[model samples]
Target: MKVREKKRPFQVFFHDNAVDSYLVTKRATKKVVASIRAAYYDNSSKELDARYRGELLVYQTVKVRQRQAEHAEKFYSVDDDHCDLQVDHGEATKRWCYYFENISVEELSHPMNGTRLR
Candidate 1:
């Protein structure tokens, strides 16, 4: 008998500004959602980090609420750039939520390939 791992259902929410700005297509939205979901299931997913840190000009932050009555916050800055997606794992609710913001479609679609601009 094989035991199956239960997959958690993640909810992806976009900031009103982000939806109105760069998330103009279903494809783009799906891509972002998939990336976030992958990250949630596996914290060590290198592909997720590579997409944001290398190809895309998007910043991501991960925060896990501490398991304490005080409810302290532990922040993880994935990169040096400004945050585009604020991924939060709630301790009380045991819910995964992705807050999207600071989207730059043009820059993300066509990131510079190590070419210095004068």
Candidate 2:
């Protein structure tokens, strides 16, 4: 004889709309980039006691305005919980012994303003 089992999957919903936001900057010159509409947030939830654990879903929308043109785009992504643990006592000891034998920033010099603006 055999027994039957039930299983459930995760659910998600995504939306697209203009998300109003702003960018604030402070320096010698104070400026506030206002009315920069971008991707907005959507509702998200997960089952607390489901058959599966360590699952995530994310939704985002973005807006682009170029030369009197505007458009909106939506995106979705899902991920799972993963990690690794290891033991390397010998390697750790070797790394700690050479920690202070590195060079300082002042001992090296490089050029700036060499990058071209796209």
Candidate 3:
């Protein structure tokens, strides 16, 4: 018998550049964001981490509250059903950048070429 994995809601944060990409329209982006929020609020089991090179990088967000000594920072893992976001490592900068444009639910459901959608 195979053990079943628990499903849980997860959060996704888009990088500033990813949100500004021309390949992603405001309407589409809004839809995606809404879906994620709904899933999380609904308590659905879904990983929220972005995937690259067979590695899972948890999505993280840092929040700072005014006049508050403690701020909350959270990281999320992507659902197995959702396509992990693609990323590229900058050789010059030694940093990782994620791609968000041209990503469709279909693509997320089924990733091809292990690369960013065109």
Candidate 4:
């Protein structure tokens, strides 16, 4: 026998729209570079989480700027009932660790022309 389950997340939904996201800092870029340099680094879990959050910020911004007020997605405050113990550990790496770690600033900031880190 099997069962289906639904779960809530532990992420904060509130975000500032100001253009000062830290995913592309010079420091962050350096970290990304270093991670790539360290071949076979088994940190795909962390990297994937960063990448996922980065994409979310970009896509959310794109939606805010392009969509009308009523249609725009609203950022809501977190509620106690909605909170969960387990959080997203981020995506599982689909390729080698190096492939997952080769993220760059340009790609994070501009998804349309994201840098190919392969």
For model 4, the superposed segments whose C-alpha errors exceed 4 Å read 1-49, 68-118
Candidate 4 global CA lDDT score: 0.42
Give the runs in model 1 whose Cα sits over 4 Å from its true position.
1-24, 44-118
Q: How many residue pairs in model 4 have overlapping backbones?
A: 0
What's the TM-score of each model vs. the native? 0.18, 0.15, 0.20, 0.17
- Give the lDDT of residue 50 in candidate 3: 25
lDDT of 1 by residue, 13-101 (tens): 23343443433444455666777777765764554567556333232222222244235545532322353443443421222212233
The true-structure Cα RMSD of candidate 1 reads 23.6
lDDT of 4 by residue, 1-118 (tens): 0011111111111143333443334345555556665643445444445867757766777787777665444433222233532222221123223344665322655445656768
Candidate 2 — which pairs collide?
39-61
Tell me the tens digit of each residue's lDDT in model 3 across 1-116: 01111110111113444533434355455566677678775552334322442133132222224324342223333322245532322421221212232233224554466676
Model 2 per-residue lDDT tens digits across residues 53-104:
3132211112223422432232222221232221355644454444435543
lDDT of 1: 0.40
Best by lDDT: 4
Say which candidate scores most in TM-score: 3
